[model samples]
Target: MTDNLNEFNKGELIIENKRDKRLDNALLTTYEGDTLLSCVYIEHNSLPELSIDDVDTTTTFFGKQVPFPLMINAMTGGTEQGVEINEALYNISKELGIPMEVGAQDVLMEDMDTAELFLGEIVEEVNRPTVLLSNLHANSSVADIKVAMDTINADGIALHLNPGQEIFTKDGISNFVGRYESIEKAAKEYGDKLIVKEVGFGMSEEVIKKLVDVGVKNIDVSGSGGTNFVEIENLRNFDYDFSELYEWGVPTAKSIINARNISKDITIIASGGIKTSLDIARALILGADMVGISGEVLKYLIHGGYDYAKDYLQELMYKTKIVMLLLGCKNIEQLKKTPYKLTGKLKEII
Candidate 1:
């Protein structure tokens, strides 16, 4: 078993190597250029005409008043390079008054030294009333969840589900049998704090119902049609097994619509392929309480540096204001009630 584990770790290292090599290429190709999907489309004759400053963007999340309803989604934070990325993200998040989520803490769960080096230090450097979120894989034990939360003093624990990524990953764990039960157990044990998040693949209406039944309060609709984790994993492994599944899950816009229709009580975070402020507005109109950004920001930060990423975020903010003004909405809540037509693939899904 030890030998098997060692081989698996080595394979993972190789996959990581390939991923890092293609990182710049992917970012440059997708974001710096424009082949990426925005996942938002304005209906014919539906554009609103208004001044940008007249648009209000403030919204409340987790009882905290955030200036914008945007969050930097969990991306990385176990390796040395992850530490630097987290620090840069922290500074930008603090300045922007947006929440930030760190990558999964599986490494920290195993080693106290690694926890202190990677997770603990990142949280400390971000020193602010910022919404600091910690992450755990769905199969994480209750004890592991507690350790992850305690290690980072997380404002909320994000339980990430990524079975598709696992299947494509060369050295991945595929024991997703009792994830619902495990999440339920964690929520029951730590009901006041934990937030469940889907990674890349969106949650079904059935799964959403089950989670709500299990007492989970917050959900990130990390839907499909954005950052294709299956594609990413397949590229890393040189495999085509799950390539079809790359377009398998629901879109972020559709997920938010389904989730809102089912339960308006839980906080809904719309993510997946969200890249611009127009995407943010479309999500809000569809009932997203907050929008989580990852791939787009990662692209900028990794290639162009922190200043470039900050400017990108500022551009998104500017776009969001324009969206609000056009919709004749003042704040995020008004944006939610703003009338608009959902067409294209979004109409088909929702």
Candidate 2:
């Protein structure tokens, strides 16, 4: 049965067709009723009053200077349709002058031809000085990590932790038990390049400390309140009884706060459920070095096409500028040190 499921998972049907449906369902389920970041409140009263024009949005990551502290998070690859999506995303990223990350490179690691055909095309198309990020699952070995990174000429690799997805998916790979040592080993071996990331489920202060102890300098809080991978996997299964739990995990704002409280040295990339420039501003204020956009970008591209996505990105930039001006922030650094008030669940969690 597992073999059959593996075959079912391998074909183009899984990613090409099912992927869209999964994404749609995940978005609907995650953001259907209320806003996740609603719990966070910006205190304009007690905080220093500033204008949006004063905000400086420039930021640096991994020694690369980014015009804005925003990255298009790893979205899709390894399938034929994924190539088109990647091209569209890369084009937007290039136009916006922000860094971008490719989807998981597991397929590339297994098949060099696929890497050249898909990932290589993406790199070539986005011929700008964008920060290219490669990806691998946490369970991947040191060799797998190296291959995944080298496959795409990644500026850095995002080692993702998705135990919930692995467990929830039908025919999912079990025994995702030995990631700590593997992460440590990968960090030691590729400390120069890899950026460890969490998928949906947020990382805690304790987890951040452990990763720091293991020599990780970069961490992406791909926290919850965005694309619910468990929900996506559950949609794929259709038989899961715990579908409601898809709404589980950390909100992007809270995750940023936790990350900031734990380690000031590690680069924090806020993701999971990020939509607007206000969300980006909130993340930066909460202590994220950069913010990641995925599901929203994909939705824009699917419904409104590439031009629409570009417009959306431009609007986001405008919103970011407005936020910075209002905060009187001259740059991304100032935004980070800027004061923000937390309320609701976020205040409790923080």
Write down the TM-score of every candidate.
0.85, 0.87
Q: How many residue pairs clash in each candidate?
A: 0, 9
CA lDDT scores, all candidates in order: 0.73, 0.74
lDDT accuracy of residue 224 in candidate 1: 74
> 237-315 in candidate 2: lDDT tens per residue?
8666666676777777777777888877778888887888778878877888888888888777766667777788888
What would the C-alpha RMSD of candidate 2 be, to one decimal place? 6.2
Best by TM-score: 2
State the TM-score for model 2: 0.87
**Across residues 72-121, which tens digit of lDDT does each residue of candidate 1 receive?**
99887776556556667776887888988888888886677777544434
Clashing residue pairs found in predicted model 1: none
Q: Which window of 10 residues has the lowest lDDT sum in candidate 2?
A: 1-10
